[model samples]
Target: MTRSLLDPSAVPAELRPYLAELVQRVGILCGPHLLSVFAVGSIALGDYRHGRSDIDVNVVVEPSLPGEVVRELAESLADGALRCPAAGLELVVYDSAFVGRPSDQAGYLLDLNTGPLLPERVSFDPAAAPAFWYVLDRSIAYQSERVLYGRPVRHVLAAPSQRHLLAALMASVREHTTGIGHLPDNQVLNGCRSVAFCRTGRWAAKREAAQIISESEPDFRPLLETAVRSFERPRTAALELPATEVRTFLAWVRERVEEAAESRL
Candidate 1:
């Protein structure tokens, strides 16, 4: 099997030590069963904010990895244990077999969340996780091609299909519009990113996507700018945007995604 490790020189200096320790701990825990370790989200997208972003990671392991090892790995790297330097560490462990397969549903061996912005959760069941978010995340990770360790990302992870991505984008829009979860800044930026992804079959950072929209649709520039500013600043408390306007923006995103999907047909 192909193997590679991230070049510390390639990442921000502040993250160097944390990532080094993470690789070391994971290597010790998973041993030969470890297939790969990669970063996704803001880190991969080159928009990592020192205090705002989560250190999103995807760890792939051989199908034979022991359940005990999985639990131990989670417990070891959890925020307090590994000492997450960012807002948190959102890590998902995927069986190598699952990475090789294509499916509409999301599946993972472990979903560990640790950070100050959110509560801690160490989840093992896919049924308990948000499948749409996983679908979108997998698509983004595959596209980002940021591999911190092991074989190349393309060699290990199959890209989620456009249909699945669009479906996930639609679901995300619906979820945000309902205002059941997610912060206002997240809701706004996510909507902008979804719209941009639908228009161009490429993933862009949240801030980048907002810029794309502002240039193309000047009418929404003010709102998009506000969201981008909010995203850059450190969070102190829950923030809110105009609900009606946020919903309206998401509706436009849903419409655009539908249009893009239809064009492919």
Candidate 2:
């Protein structure tokens, strides 16, 4: 099976060295608690865009870690020494017991959303961590995790059922679409990708997912095209898609996602 760390050759050429540096630094920081580390999200999905993608990693440690140690690890990740390879490094360190089974409380020791110069205050308490959305992260990890150390991903992670995954995606879509005004292009495309996953078992990158949706629903082609281009060239300034159309499309997608989720239920 696919049980090894991601091949550097598979990553963007510029990102290889930095990816290697991450593995080494994480291994050092976690020490005995570190059971395994794996790459997830777009990096593992083979749809990583150089300028836009954040390297998402899951660190599996012992059942529990001392609060102090967790703090240190968080600081290390935010430190300039371990600069992120792309937009930023998005990471979550999960207690092994938490991953082995579900819990009422957060399962992570540390979680952060940080990039080169914009480091958010890292949190050690799982409950306080902003990125503790387990269902979504676990689903993504189950689908595309690549081992950086320890046992293979299949051995470490329990695959989430399609029903569970769809439900989580629908919940996210409902939350994001509920607000008024134009949803960001990334969020818009993410809703499309989640719908795509519900229809097809495969996990598609944002651009690929938008393409599939546009083909399946021609009316949204122009919007999806705009979103895809924005994702590809984050630096380029572009005209925004009309807010009315964006809201309409999101509402339509929200209904379809809810329908799909209900069927599974």
Candidate 3:
């Protein structure tokens, strides 16, 4: 399993130490809550485009939401890193937690889009891969790393469905491409490949996506673009798909996602 803490050594001379530190600090604050926070958007998905992705984190808070926790979150938001949005602080907050059954082969993302006001303990997955959807239910693992503060962050699995993850991603891609009516071929193919692997049990998708990403040095600009497309193609509501093919699709999509995620570091 990939540890939530990434190796900052290979990061670009300019961004290596900086982003390495940022992800690490994110871990610290998240660790106390028994939550795992990971760079998702352009950074983690390896599809960043310029000015497209700000630091985005996919967080799953543990235990449950307590009113007192909300107050602590307010202070945490005082820091500039936290961004305010309909989701209260879109950037990061302990109040909002992603619920997923790490053991399930099929899952879908659920986030408190309304705000950090997590009145309930619900499940959410905040990841994007336009062409396809995937479920890393078994692959999901928890790892710890250092953050800005003298603290560490622990990552836990926030499993989501392979189909749902892909559909929302395609919607995002089409939105950004000005192809609102249709999704980009690359997004569909790549995502299809991803979904194929995740839904079914194909091993080829991982290698293929990695090959494309490996050919070039990891860069966040492209990943950011993907993130923008994802944001644009936001789903009006969750769409359902048969869970049968999940293993195969996820296999392919994971390859591409990892390729782009490499750039995030």
Who wins the lDDT comparison?
1
Q: Model 1, 44-137: lDDT tens per residue? A: 8888887778888899999999999999998899888878878888899999899886666769999999977758999989889768978887
Stretches of candidate 3 exceeding 4 Å from the true structure? 1-6, 10-31, 46-52, 65-98, 102-155, 177-265
Per-residue error for 248 in candidate 3, Å, reads: 30
TM-scores for candidates 1 onward, in order: 0.94, 0.87, 0.37
Question: Number of clashes in every candidate structure?
Answer: 0, 0, 72
Clash-forming residue pairs, model 1: none
Model 3 agreement with the true structure over 1-265: per-residue lDDT tens digits: 1123444542223334445444454445445553544443334434333222233444445556444544444344433444322222223333323344432222323332223332222323334322222233122212212232322233344333444444434433333334243323233334443433433433233224434433442442244234224434333322222232322333434554554434332
Ranked by TM-score, the better of candidates 1 and 3 is: 1
Ranking by TM-score: 1, 2, 3
Global CA lDDT of candidate 3, please? Answer: 0.36
